[model samples]
Target: MDRPQIPLNALRAFESAARHLSLTRAAVELCVTQAAISHQIKSLEERLGVNLFRRVPRGLVLTDEGAALVPVLTTAFDRMSDTLDRFMDGRFHETLHVGVVGTFAVGWLMPRLRAFEALHPSVDLRIYTNNNRVDLAGEGLDLAIRFGDGSWRATVAERLFSAPMSPLCRPEVAHVLASPQHLEGQALLRSYRADEWPRWFEAAQAPCPPLRGPMFDTSLALAEMAAAGHGVALLPVRLFATYLENGRLARPFEAEVETGSYWLTRLHSREPSPAMRAFREWLVDAARAADERPDLLRENALSATDQSL
Candidate 1:
C-alpha cells in the first residue's frame, strides 16, 4: 500500500490555527498573513476530503476531524524537537549510566555530581541507586559503585577508599555510652552483614552482645534509624560526616573496624568509553583529596607525637 503525500507546511498551519482557535493568532505565531493560514488549512481539508474547521462569528471551531489530527501532530512535533535539541555544535550527546549503592549515592556521589556535570558537559550522566547488591550486566549498567572487598566474579574493581564501620547513635544515646562496655546493654541496630557489629566490638576491645536487632539492607536507612534514637548503628563515618557534623548522629568511641572498601567496578569483559575513563580518573582524585583532610592530617601528627613520647 502507498501513502498519500501531505505538505508539512499545511499540517503546521492547521495545527497552529486549531490550537489558538483563531486564524489571526495562528498567522501572528507563524509570522504569516491571515489569508495564508486560511488558505493552507483549506487546502489541507480539501486534500483529506474533510471539514477541519467551521468559521464562527468571533473565532474558529475545530470539527471532529481537526480535533483527532491535532494531538497526533502535536506529539510528533514535540518528540522531533526534543531529539534535535540533543545535538549541540554537530556533536551527539553521550549518556553514561551508573548504578551506585544507596549509601554512597546519597552520602557522597550526589554531592559531587554538580562538579562532574560542570567539567563534562557533553556527557549526560544518569545514576541509579541500589542496595550495594547490583548486577552490572543484567541491569544494563555501564559501571557500579559498590561497597565490598572488590572480588566479584567476572568484574574489574578499582578501590576507592576504606570506610571503616563505627558505632553511631543520637546525642542522647552517646551521652549514656561512656565506654565500649556500655554498648552491651543498648539496642544494637544491625545490617545484613552479621559480622560488622562483632568486628567493631573487637576493635573497641568490648564484649560483643547477643546478635539481636532489626536488620537493614542499606547503611543510609540504618543511619536514619540511629538518628531517630532507635538504636546504635554501626555505620561508615566518612560517608555520614554530615549527620555527625549536624549533631543528628554521634560516634561514642574512636575505634573503627575496617571490614571492606568502596570500589568502582564494571564487567571485566567490557571496554571503557571516554566518559567512563574521565569519570574514573576524576573519582579517584576526589577520593584521594577527601582522604587527606586537614583534620585527619592533624590527628595523624598527634598520634605520631604521642608514639614518639
Candidate 2:
C-alpha cells in the first residue's frame, strides 16, 4: 500500500480547526477565510477517506478517526516548531546541559551566570543542581561541576580551584569562641564526608570531638543551618561570601583546612561540543579571576567581625 499524498497546508487547516472546533476561529488564527478553512479540511478528509469532524449546531465534534489523528498531527507540528525555533540569526542554537553541585550553583555560579549569558547568546545553557555527588552519563549531563579531588573514574576532570574548609557559625556562636577548643562543646554540624570536621580540628590544633550533630548532603543546607544558629558548620568560606559579608554567618579562628577542590568534569567517552568548549573557557577564566582576588576573600571573612565590633 502507498502512503497517501496529503498537502501540508490542508493538514495545518485540519489541525487548527480540530483544536478550535470552529472553522471561523481557525480561519482567524490561520489568517484565512472561514470558507477557505472549510475547503482545506474537506480536502484533507477526502484524501484520507475519513469523516474527521461532525458539523453540529453549536460548533464541531471529532469522530474516533479525528481523535486519533489529532494527537499525531499535534506531535508532528510541535516537533517542527521546536526545530524551527533553534534557528536564530542564520545559525542553529547549540544546547549545553550542565549539572553543578548545589553549593557552587547558588554560592558561586549564580552571581556570574549573567556574564556567561551575555558572552554567548547562541548557546542554550541549561543547568541542573545536585549535591556534590553526580553521575554524568547516568543523568545525561554534558558536563558536571563537582567539589572533590579530580579522581573520578572514566572522567576527564579539570581542577577549577580549591575552597578550603573553615568553621562558620552565627555571630552569637562565634562570640563565645575565643579559641578553637571552645568548639568541642558546641554542636558540630557535619557533611556526608565524615572526615571534614576531624580534618578541620587537626588544622586548628584542637582535639577532635565525636560529632553527633545533624548530617547534610549539600553544603548550601549545612551553611543555612549554621546561619540559623543550629550549630557550627565546616564549609567553604570563599563560596559563602555573601552570607559572611551580610553577617548572617561568621568564620571564627581563621584556620581553614584544604580537603578537596572543585573540578569541571565530563565523561571521557563523550566528545565536547562547541558550546561546551565555550562554557569551559569562560568558567576557567572566571575561576582564575576569582583566585587572583584575595583581598575580596579577606574582606568577606572580616566583614562579620567588623560588624560585631
Candidate 3:
C-alpha cells in the first residue's frame, strides 16, 4: 500500500489564494494565470473530497478544511525556501541549532565561537541562550550547554569542565574581607539553589552566615550586582575573568564550592546530525585545550594576577 501523494503545485496555489483571498492575486504571485490557479485548486478539492473555498459576492473564503491545510503548506514552503537559500559557493551549509546557559555563553563560549566558525565553515551555528534552564526538544535545539551535575532526566550529557562558585564582590567590599569568617557580616546575594551560600561557607571552614539579598536566576545578573556593590555573589570566577581583569569584581576568598560543572547535553533519543557531530567534536576539543591552561587555576583557589586568566 502507498500513501496518497499530495500535489505540490496544488498546495502552493491553495496556500497563496487562501493568504490573499483572491485567485487573481495568487496567479500574480505564482506567475501563472488565474484559470490555472483555479483549476489546480479544483483538482485538489476533488482529490481530497472536500470543498476548500467558499466563493462569495466579493471574493473567496477558505472552508474549515482549507484553513487547516494552508498553515501546514505555508510552513513547509517557507522552510524549503530557507534551506535553498543556504546554498553558497557550490556548498550547502548545514545549520546546527543549540541552546546555552547565559553565563557560559557570555563568559566563555562567545570568545571561542570565532575559532569554531573558522574550523567548520560549512556548519552554521545557531545559539539560543537561557538562564541555565531550557527544554531542548520543546525548543527544537540540537544541543544545550548548561551548568549542572550532568543528571538532567532524558538527557545524555558530556562533561565540559568544572566551574565552581566563589564569593565575588566590588573592590571596596574586598578591602573589608580579611578572612572567609568575616563574610558572615556582609550582604550575601544568592541563587535559587538555597544551598550554594551555606555550601560555600562550609567549604571555607567558616560558619555559614545568615544569607540575605536579592536572588537571581542568572550569574550574569548576579555578577553585575556584586560589581555594583550590592552584595557578594557566589559565582564561577573563571567565567567572569573579564570582571576581575577590568577591576569590576574581585574574589574575596580563595575558598570555593562545587555546585555543578558545565556540560554539553542533548536529548537521549535524538540522533546526532552531521553538523551537530562536528560541533560537538570541535567543542569538546576546545574545552580540553582550555583545561590544559596553566592559569586555569584550581577550582578551590584562584590567582587574581595570573595574567588575567
Candidate 4:
C-alpha cells in the first residue's frame, strides 16, 4: 500500500509533542492551545493506526512507535536545517567550519584571524568556540583545536604548541608574592579541571593545599577573574601573555608546569580542501615563528597583525 496522506500540521504537532513529551509544553512552543495540540496528535495517531503517546497522570510518555520515529524525524530536520544553512550566504565561497577552545580563541586565534581572512579572501570561515572538549565529526567542524596528548581515535592530530601552567594574578597582588609559599594565604581560583592547582603548586615546590574557590568552566574566565584581583589562577602562561605584558595580570611566582599542548585536528575521513590546506600551512608557519621569537618570553606581541592570534 502507498503511504497515507499525512497532514503537515498533525506531523508538526506530533513532532513537537513527542520532543517535549508534553502536549501543553509543545503547544506553548508552537503557540497553539494545548487542546489543539492534543487534537492534532489524536488525529495523527488515528490516521496512522498507532498509539504515539501514553497519557500518564503527571505527563505524556512516548510509546515504542513514537520512540522509534523520533530519530528519523530528527535526522530529517537536521538535514533540512543544514541545507538551509548552506544557502544562507548566497555566494560561491567555500565554507570552512572550525571549532576552537575558548582559551585558544581569545588568547591565540582571535589575534591572527584577520591574517587568515587576508590570505584566503575567498574562503568563508565559520568559527565556533567550545571548552576544549569537542566532537570533530558530530559537530560538522572541518577542524578543531583541542588540548590533549594527541591521541584521539579516528582523527589526525598535529601539535600546535605546549601550554604550561603558572600562578597569575594582578600586579598589586604580585608585589606581596616573594615566593611560592605566600600563595597559600591568597584566594585560589580554580578551573573545572581539579589538577591545575595541584600541578602548579608541585611545579612551584609549594605545598598544594586544599583548593577551594569559585571554579570557572574555562581558563580564559579564570584568567579574567585573576585580572580582576578576585584571586590567583593557575593558568597557561602563553594564553594570558597579553594581560601579563599590559600589567592587567602578573605572575606571582616563576614556577611553571608543562601540562599539555594544543593540537590541530580533523576527521580522518575528510581530505583537506584548498581552504583547509592554506589554513594548515599558515598555522604551522605561525607556530614555528612563535617558537623562534625569544621576545615572546618577555612580552608576547600578541597585538601584531600576524602574531595576534
Candidate 3 collision pairs: none
For each candidate in turn, the TM-score is 0.69, 0.75, 0.86, 0.67
Local lDDT at 271 for model 2: 95
Q: Arrange candidates by lDDT, descending.
A: 2, 3, 1, 4
How many collisions per candidate? 0, 0, 0, 4
Task: Give me the candidate number with maximum lDDT.
Answer: 2
- Candidate 4 runs further than 4 Å off: 1-92, 299-309
Clashing pairs in 1: none
For model 2, where is the 10-residue window of minimal lDDT?
Answer: 300-309
How do the residues 1-309 of candidate 4 rate in per-residue lDDT, one tens digit apiece?
998788878878888888888888999998999999999989989988999999999898899999998788778777766656655446446789889999999898889889988987767898999998898888999999898899999999999888878778877787787888888889999888888788878777779877886788899888888889899988887777778767788775556788789899998999999879988888888877776753456344222211211
Query: What TM-score should be assigned to candidate 4?
Result: 0.67
- Model 3, 1-309: lDDT tens digits are 666576899989999999999999999999999999999999989988899999999999889998999899899999999999889888889999999999999999999999989988888889999997799999999999988889999999999998878898887788788889888778888888999988987889888878766789999999998889888889988789888877787776777888988999999999999898999999999888887872555432345523223
Q: How many clashing residue pairs are found in candidate 2? A: 0
Lowest-lDDT window of 10 residues in candidate 3? 300-309
The local lDDT score (0 to 100) that residue 135 gets in candidate 4 is 89
In order, the Cα lDDT scores of the candidates are 0.86, 0.91, 0.87, 0.82
